[model samples]
Target: MSAAGSGPEDLARGVLEGGARSIGRAISEVERDSVTVPAILRRVFPRTGRARIIGITGPPGAGKSTLVQRLAQAYRRAGRRVGIVAVDPSSPFTGGAILGDRIRMSEIYTDPGVFIRSMATRGALGGLARATSDAVDVLDAAGFDPILIETVGVGQDEVDIVRAADTIAVVLVPGLGDDIQAIKAGILEIADVFVVNKAEREGADRAVAELSMMLDLAGHPEWRPPIVKTSAPSGSGVPEAVAALEAHGAHLAASGEGRRRRSLRARSRLLALLETRFRRAIEARAPEPDGLEQAVAAVAERREDPYSAAARLFEELVPPPREAAERRSG
Candidate 1:
């Protein structure tokens, strides 16, 4: 963490110099929505867009964490600095991560080449923390190449990972029952690579065959996602998975899809930031009775419809276009 007196410029300078503590502090500020966030982002924005962001998502109990750890190890072997952001389900009582993914990745904690941060979903939808993308940018600016994001894997909504990662790998385990049902949960469309982990298990081949059949049915003409089998504990098949991811990266570049994805990412970030700022401004400027609070109470008491209450609140907080124009002219 950065010192209490350190300014945003100093913190940003430390982040650019690859100081792990500074990186941690910067992400903490982002998560807190600190007053200095805009300043820090301004300084670090130019240093971002250099890292490869990979999103690993899948059904629960599919060993996604192990795969992420293995992938980090493989990237480390290649002498690449790796950054990991693991989004865990929030604890209802504390609003903190329930089971930190870093525990499963204990081996890599000591490696100076690897930086890992575990984030709580904090009730955000889409299996990702709201601040996860910002955290990735912090790591990227700190010189980590190949940043890995592991989502909470809440089935259907996990597709949100596509907006955050350059390439997404959806992991599945054999013997999980009804593989088709899992695919139908919306992960099938977002996967750049399908990984059948626990390959030594009885139904590994069956899982692969089922995925292949589905891909055939879907017909991806531009680039078909490849399936790779791996047993992460023993590190078997990890190299092949890495190769498949690298191949996808190459295809994305050669086919111009990479630029398209980056554009989408930028758009998503802008919209998210705008939404956040609007909500904050509304709350901060609400009247003493708090327009939002009164609206909620009214709707709860059945005195007013939610739609009407929301419109009233918006009108109260925001001037109508004609009023604004007249005021400016006056």
Candidate 2:
């Protein structure tokens, strides 16, 4: 079992059986590493891969929260249990999260079929929580039909959420200047869906047209990502957006693309696991006394070349490049 299974599975089983307090406490424990989550995951992980993980990202102030709320409502009407993960940004000064998704989706919190969790970025890139994929596995096992992950609206860096989701939705507002330039080529290319929010504003069509034109230029394969217009506040175009998302989900099912995409996601998650294990190993080795400080101080005093000092530190603390290859071969 690869040295996994460090803890009892009874708690997680209780979580699956809809024990609310058990689920919450286990999630917190996993988050803080009070237990080895990776070990636990290996024991409990089974990829049903049925939930369509939809990632909604956009520039800040794009009404993503409202749009997600509307989407969740639509899914509920369709008779599906929905799981929502809203990733809010971390406060730079306090090193704490300022989570704010509850205000947007308050209507559905008490819904019998809906489960919502707001996770702070916790300084993870792609604006996802450090334990997001783990949490997604939990929701998936608990039988949530549609899992929606909403990231703090940022640019390309946050778009890495595509690796975690089956469909990627990039939200943009109407009348925003430099819509294409704002999104940049990096994240735009990965989108499976693009939504223009606040359709009531002026230049709505222009924004849509711009995105369409960009998509055309990119020559996206398999299927071109659909662009939808929505105004979540007034509930305009929400139905259409929902329809488009549902259609996309159906296509994934029929084309066997759902399995393929999730397999890719699984592979990505595994690589992340190995990387995390490696990082933990390195940290556990305990760095030499004042190593980083000595290097920095040396550079400040102009006593040695910074590049050479960095090379030396890497060699001393980390497995050498050649030895890493040897271990892999072994």
Candidate 3:
């Protein structure tokens, strides 16, 4: 733990120097929701913003893991250090990460320049573990150039997790009828690049055509998501997909969208932190044990509605001005 004699400051320094053990431990701290995460991030924040965060998401059976493996290899070959956070579905019994994705990428498991971590979604609806952004920060501080986040393959809600990425690639495959239409209104809106994986399949061309039509109907903006066809096993179109990713990065830099995206990420992180702190504070000041049980019982019996109970709790925590004034006068 970072909280040992050397402390979070030491851990942060190790992370900045790209110590592999330190990076792994730091990410573990974040995953465990340690109290030291904020302190560690404070020390390493300056070293961040250097890594380009890329998010990969899609429906199940989209071959996302295979595509991610190929992309990581391409980046490594190009001399870029890659950090991969593979968000996997949680094991129902243990609440731990399922290692299927990691197992699929076994070939690159030992690569020195590539670091991969499999995280369980832990019931988060966004297809990402709650600690995902924090894990990315740890990787960034460790000087990973291109950080990749692979979401659990939940179609519509995948966008929430990938919003943290500088460029989001939505992976889709052929022969999945109506999949495009199902996700078009949500994840499609967040994509900077659309990937047609298993493009050699029968309906691959039709899938591409449908995506093109959707992009057209969405109204041509200054930055249109480019669709890249990829057949991962054969390494087909992998380079082109990488090129599209790089192009989007270039576009973000040239158009100043990168700064805007960073700002949004910062704002969202701050709000989440604030919400967490506020909840903790309220919990610390929770009603007396018996009172709490009574309240719960009331709600369970439907004698007191949850909404009204919540309002009462809020008022008790932060008294209304009128009540405070009356108390002062009295």
Q: Which residue segments of model 3 deviate by more than 4 Å?
A: 1-6, 90-107, 123-129, 153-157, 287-308, 318-330
Give candidate 2's error at residue 261 in angstroms. 2.1
TM-score of each: 0.85, 0.78, 0.84
Per-residue alpha-carbon lDDT of candidate 2 for residues 153-253, written as tens digits (9 for 90 to 100): 55545665545788888888877667568556656766778899999999899989988888888887777889999988777998888878878888888
- In lDDT terms, which candidate is top? 1
Q: Residues 237-320, candidate 1, lDDT per residue (tens digit)?
A: 999999999999999999999999999888877887777777887788766575677878889999999898878778887899
Candidate that would win on TM-score: 1
- Report how far off residue 153 is in candidate 1 (Å): 1.7
Q: What are the Cα lDDT values of the candidates?
A: 0.81, 0.71, 0.79
Model 2 residue 262 lDDT score: 82
As for model 2, its CA RMSD to the true structure in angstroms is 5.5
Superposition error at 267 for model 1 (Å): 1.9
Task: Give me the overall lDDT of model 1.
Answer: 0.81
lDDT of 3 by residue, 132-162 (tens): 8888888998889799988744555556667
Select the stronger candidate by TM-score from 2 and 3.
3
Q: After superposition, how far is residue 35 of candidate 1 from its true place, in Å?
A: 2.9
Error of 2 at 136 (Å): 0.7
